[model samples]
Target: MKRTNEKIAEQFKTFQILDEEGKVVNEEAMPKLSDDELKELMTRMVYTRILDQRSIALNRQGRLGFYAPTAGQEASQLGSQFALEKEDFILPGYRDVPQLIWHGLPLYKAFLFSRGHYIGNQFPDGVNALSPQIIIGAQYVQTAGVAMGMQKRGQKSVAITYTGDGGTSQGDFYEGMNFAGAFNSPAIFIVQNNRFAISTPVEKQTAADTLAQKAVAAGIEGVQVDGMDVLAVYTVTKEARERAVNGEGPTLIEMLTYRYGPHTMAGDDPTRYRSEELDNEWEKKDPLVRFRKFLEEKGIWSEDEENAVIERAKDEIKAAIKEADNTPKQKVTDLIGNMYETLPANLNEQMEEYKAKESK
Candidate 1:
C-alpha cells in the first residue's frame, strides 16, 4: 500500500528502529538484514569513523590539505548507497566520502583526494563512476543531465545526486528538478539536510516548510526521511529509485540529519554559532549507537564481535592512508596531458611560455 501523507510525515520525522539505550523500538520496520550484513554495516560505520578522525588529524598535522569529516553521518551515507544499484550513477558532494566508499571506492582514493591528488577523481578499472563535486549545487544539474541521457538511451538506470541543505537554495536545484519533471527523467535528488550549511543554519536557507516539499512546485513527488535511521533512509531511497525506473519520474528526498562536527577542516568554527549543548544532544542520538542497540535487542550484536570489526577496519584504513601518501605525485606536464585531444591555441601558447621559463 502506498504510504499516506500522515504516515510519510511520521516516517520522515522518526523511523528509528533503535532507542538511545540501544533497544529496538520499531520491530516491523527493523531491517531483515542477516547477521553478516548487519556486522558489515557496523564495520563500515567503524571504518568511516576511523577514516574521518584520521583525516581530521592529518589536516591538523599538515599531512593533508582540507578535510570534510562525515563522522556523525555514516548511517545516512552508507544506507543510501547500499540502496543503490551498481549501474546507477551517483553525484556526490565533498562530504560524502562514506557514500563513495560504499560504492566501492578504495580508501586510498579518498586519502589521495584529501591530500590534493588529481588522479583520485579518475575511477579505477571496472569501478562504478563517482567523481566528487566540490561546487555546492553544481552536481544537481549534472546528474539530471546524466539521467536525461540515460532516458534518451532507454536505460532503466537512475542517477542519485547528493547535496547539502544549503545546495537546495541554489538555482541549479530548481533547474534540475524542472528538467527532470519535464522529461520524466530517471533521477533522485537527495538533500542531506544536515541542518547547517557550513555555519548557516537551514532556517536561513529557505522557508518552504521542508526541502522535500519543494518538489511539488517542480511537479514531482517529495519525500522526507529520518536520515539518522539507516533503515528509514534505505526504504525510502529504494522506493524512489523503483519509481524512477518504472517511469514515474523523479523523487526529491530531504534527509533530516545534523552535522555534529565543523563543516570542514578549512571552514569557520561551528562553535561560533552552534551550541555545544546541542552537539552533546546529537551525540546521544548518534546513529551508530542507536543502530547497535537495535541490533543487540535482536540478539545480533556482541561486544567481542564489534571490537574485532573495529580492529580490522583500523588496520585497513591505516594501510590505505599509507598507500595514498606514498603514491607518486603527478608530474608538472600532467595538467596539459590530461586535457582535450587537441589543445587550444591559447593553452598551447601558455604551455610554451611556461616551458621556456623553466628552461631559462
Candidate 2:
C-alpha cells in the first residue's frame, strides 16, 4: 500500500512554472503568451483580488449576502478561466464567482446572486454558465451531464467545474469523472486543494496521497499543478481543454492553492483551525505577488498599470453593487416561477397565490 501510494505520488508530481520568488523554475513548461496577454491575466487577478476585498467589506456592512473569499486563489480561478473559450460551459462552486464573472456573467448579477436575488440566476444572452453551486460537489455531476450533451451535439466546447479539497471526498466527484470517462465526455474537473475545507484540513479529508490521483479510479487523466503560478495553471488548463475537445476524455486537475481568508463570509474563522504561521507561508506564494514579479521582470507590468486596474475594479464594483441594490426585491413568486419552465399545477397555484400576496 505504501509503495502504491508512493508511485501515484511520483507520477503526479506538482507541475510548476514559477517558483515562490516569481522565478521560472521550469522554463520548458512556460506558456507561450504575448506580453499583452500576460498583462491581461495579471489584470484579471488583481481585479479579482480587489473584488474579493470589496465583497468581504460589503458582507460585513450587510450590503451583500453569502460570499466565499477568492483572495489567494486568483491564479487557480482566473488562469483556468482564461484558457476557456466563451462557448465552454462553467459550473462553479460557491467560491468560484470570479470564474463566472470572467466567463461573462455580469458583475452586477454576481452581486445580486450573493444577495439572494432571483435576477442573479438569470444569465444574459450569450453567457454560458450556471450560477455558483453552493452544495459542495453537486456541480461535478452536472458538468458530466453537460459535457455529454456537448459530445452528443458534436460541439467542440467542454464542460468545466470547480470544487475544493473537501469536495473531492463527495461521491459526486467520483461519479462525475466516471461518467465522463465512460462516455468520453469533454469535461474538466478542477479541485482547488487549498489545504483546508472550512475548519477541516485536507489531510483529514481523505487517506489518498493526493486528490488528482483519485482520477485513476475513474479512468481519466489527472495531474496536480502549482495553483500559485498563473502561467502554469493556464498552460495545464489549455492542454486539458484541448484534450477534452479532441475526444480524449476528461482530465481532473488538482490546483495546489490556498485561500487567505475564511471559508465564507457566513462565519468561518480560519485562525480557529489554522495557524498564522501557515497563513504567512501561503502569503509568500500569493498568486498576484509572484505573477506580478514575473511580469515586472519582463517589463510587461507596472504598479501604475495594476493601480489603474484596481481603481477600475473598485469603480465597477461600486456600480454593480448600486445596480444590485436597485433591483426589485426577490419575490417568492419569482422563485417558484423560475424554478421550472412549466410549473406543475400545484406549484402554479402556489405561484399565483404568492403573486397575489406580493402584489398586495
Candidate 3:
C-alpha cells in the first residue's frame, strides 16, 4: 500500500537515539558501538570543536583566509565520514573539516590549506580525495561523474557528496541527482541542512517541505535524519552507502543540523539575522556536549580525560598554525605555470610586464 503524506511524515520525523541529557531514548535500535569506539567518537568530536574555535581565531588574526565554522555540526560531519570505507571517495564542502580530519588529514595540512598554502592542495601521496570544494554545488556534478567512472570499472566504492541547503537551489544539484539516478551510480548526496545559507533561512531558500523530498523527483529514495545525533547520521549514511553499492542507485539524506557560528570569517554578521537567544538554545543542544554526556553515562568518558584531550588538541592546532605560517610563500610565476600546458602569448606578455614593473 502506498503511504499517504501524513503517514510518510510521521515515519520520517528525524531518527534520534541519544537524548539531550545523555540518555539513550531508543537503546535497542542503537548500534553495538564498543566502549573504545565511544571514546574515540567523543575525542574526535572534542577535537573538532577545538579546531573550529581555533580556526575562527586564526581568521580573526589574519593568519587564515575566510572560513566557515563547523562548530555545532561535528556529529554529522564526523559520523558520516567514519561510516565510510577508506576506499570510498568524499566530496566535502568548505565547512567539513571534521570529516577531513577523521579521514586522516593532519591538523598541520588542514591549517596550511586554510592559510592559503599551495602544499595544502597536495594531499598525502596515494590519497585520492580532492581538496575541499569552495564553489558550492560544483562538487555535486564532479562527484556524480566520479561515481559513474567507478561503476564502469566495477569498483565497489561509493562517492559521498556534501552540500548545504542553499546549494540545493543550484541546477547542478538536480543534474547530478538525475545522472546518479539514471546510471544507478554508487553515490550519496548528503545535504547538511543547517537551516541557513549564510543569512538566508531554509524557509526562504525553498518552498519544499523537506530537502529529502527532492530526491523523489530524481527517482531515488530519501531519508531525513537528526543531524545532531551522531549515531543516527552514521547509521543512515551507512545504510545509504550499502544500498548504493548494491546498485540500488543514490540516496539523498537531509541531515537537519544547525551551525552555531558565523557563516565565514569575511563580512558575515550572523548576529544581524539570528538572535543570541537562538544561539544559546542551540548551544544547549550542542552535539559535543550531548555526546560527551552519553559517553560519560556509558562510563567511557570523564572530566580529566576530556580535559586532557582538549589540551592535546589545542597544542596540536597551535603547532600546525606555526608550521603553516612558516611554510615558504608560493612563487608568482608558479601560479600561471600551474594552470596551463603552456602560457599563451598574451598571458606570457602580461606576466613579463608585471615582473618588469616589480623589478623597477
Highest lDDT scorer: 2
The TM-score of predicted model 2 comes to 0.97
Across 1-360, the per-residue lDDT of candidate 1 in tens digits comes to: 235544434533544555666665677876567777777777777777877877788789887786787877887788888778888888899998778877878888877777768777777765555678888899889988999998999988899988999999899999989999999999999998888887788888775557887887899988877778777777778889999999999999888787777898886688998998988988887888877877777788889888887788778878887898788876545676568688799878877876776567
Worst 10 contiguous positions by lDDT, candidate 1: 1-10
Provide the lDDT at 17 for model 1.
Answer: 55
Q: List model 2 lDDT by residue over 1-360, tens digit each.
A: 988898888889999999998998999988889988998999999999999999999999999999999999999999999999989999999999999999888999999999888889889988899989988999999999999999999999999999999899899998999999999999999999999887788889888889999999999999999999999999999999999999999999999999999999888888899998999999999999999998899888998999899999999999999999998888898789788999999998998898889888
Ranking by lDDT: 2, 3, 1
User: Which regions of candidate 3 deviate over 4 angstroms?
Assistant: 1-11, 351-360
Best by TM-score: 2
lDDT of 1 at 307: 84
> Would you estimate the TM-scores of all the predictions?
0.91, 0.97, 0.94
Off-target runs (Cα >4 Å) in candidate 2 are 340-353
Residue pairs clashing in model 3 are none
- Candidate models: Cα lDDT each: 0.80, 0.93, 0.84
Give the C-alpha miss distance for residue 215 in model 2, angstroms: 1.1
Instruction: Indicate whether candidate 1 or candidate 2 has the larger lDDT.
Output: 2
Clashes of 1: 1
Q: Report the C-alpha lDDT of model 3 over 242-298, residue by residue, as the tens digit.
A: 998998999999998899888887888899988889888788888988888887777
